[model samples]
Target: MIDAIRDYWNHRIHDLEMTDQPVGTKRFFEDLDEYRFDKLHYLPRLVDFSGFRGQRLLEVGCGIGTDLVRFAKGGARVTGVDLSQTAIDLARKNFELNGVNAEELVAGNGEALPYADASFDVVYGHGVIQYTADAPRLIQELHRVLKPGGTGLFMVYNRVSWLNALSKVMQVALEHEDAPVLTKYSIGEFRQLLAPFAETSIVPERFPVKSRLHKGWKGVAFNTMFVGTFNALPRAWVRPLGWHLMAMCRK
Candidate 1:
């Protein structure tokens, strides 16, 4: 299963590293002209990249070095690891192109990180671990690499999200409900899985307002009609029902 994941990413990275497919609508933030389109949310101002200044940080799956570059530029001593050699190569090229550099970048597996234990002040993995077969193992690896009291953060699709509920309702309404397995996690489930490794918790607090949810008239209509209103709600109200479940743990 792990090898299958490596093979999957080896091929997937070709498109993921080079494409801009942010969710919501095609005309939203899906600007391919900007190479960093896929990574801006994880950067400062939006997600507090500046907080990493002078910190030792590791990004477990630094695709194309987008966030890695941001961290380095933010004054972090950054190191990156990814399962795909091609991704690491592209990341190096991107860093050079952007005049950003990291302390190290290596091709590596998330479930078995290559760094020494207790080596980093912060570790972050965004939208990466679900691709691996054993997310719990990856979490353990993340915990292992962090210094005591160090922070760890990750983003995974929320299985109990409003969008998920809508997907199921849509499927049932259309009489096309088929179980397509995706590695999604509910907040409680993720917290439980990581409890032994750290003081862990998760919150559903993001919506794909840029990437088109689906590629049809119905999808377009849904986004046009409901997405804006949904986003307009207070984050405190929307946090638990959001699409992306953010897990924060301390080791």
Candidate 2:
């Protein structure tokens, strides 16, 4: 199962559809970064990618080192690990081309991290747990590597989200839905997965944004009708139905 997941990601880079620049080039990374921030505008506002200066930060499954680079630029001593060597290679190129440095960027399994206990000041696994073969085991490893009172930031898909319902209604598949392992968790289920943490808070985010991927009438309806309608609703009432469940954990 793990091998299948790795092989799949090795061939398919996340958000590859957003860029036409040649892979591993500076333009490619820049395009991806721009598109990512545009789509996930809430990420930097919520994650404080610049707050941990001179601190040790580890990002598990850090695809192409996008967020990792941001942390590094902000003076965090960053290391990245990914299941796909292709991702690691591209990440290294991204860092080199951007004139930043990482402590390390190795291809490794998140379920069994290759570090001593309490080794990092922060551990991050954004959009990673849902695709792992053993989500609980990966969470355990993340907690194990964090120093006392260290932080863990994670994001996963919400099964009870508006996007999920819309996808089903429109008969459109979610990105990477055909992967070897893809799981979505309800709020209660996500909380249960982070039981090892001393404290945890889950925030529902990634609300309806205009589509850059979808096309035709379905896309038009989503962009014209759904986006406006959903955002127009009282946020308090629709907050729980957000597509991404972002968790902040303390060890």
Q: What are the lDDT scores of the predictions, listed in order?
A: 0.70, 0.95
* CA shift of 225, model 2, Å: 1.0
Candidate 1 residue 52 C-alpha distance from true site, Å: 2.0
**Per-residue error (Å), model 1, residue 247:** 2.3
Clashing pairs in 1: 22-210, 22-211, 23-210, 23-211, 23-212, 24-210, 24-211, 24-212, 149-251
Error of model 2, residue 132, in angstroms: 0.3
- lDDT string for model 2 (1-251, tens) is 99999999999889988989988888999999999999899999889989999999999999999999999999999999999999999999999988999999999999998899999999999999999999999999999999999999999999999999999988999999999999999999999999999999999999999998999999999999999999999999999999999999999
Q: Which stretches of candidate 2 lie above 4 Å from their native place? A: none
Among all candidates shown, the one with the greatest TM-score = 2
Which residue pairs show collisions in model 2? none
> Against the hidden reference, what TM-scores do the models get?
0.80, 0.99
Q: How much is the lDDT of residue 246 in candidate 2?
A: 95
What are the per-residue Cα lDDT tens digits for candidate 1 across 1-251?
Answer: 66666666666652342344542223221243254444234334335677879999999878767677767877888999998787787678767766777888999888888789999999999777666677789888988989999988777777778778877776523111121214777777777767855576676665546433255766776678767878787878777887677777788
**What's the residue-level lDDT of 27 in candidate 2?**
90
Assess the local accuracy of residue 233 in candidate 1 as a C-alpha lDDT between 0 and 100. 79
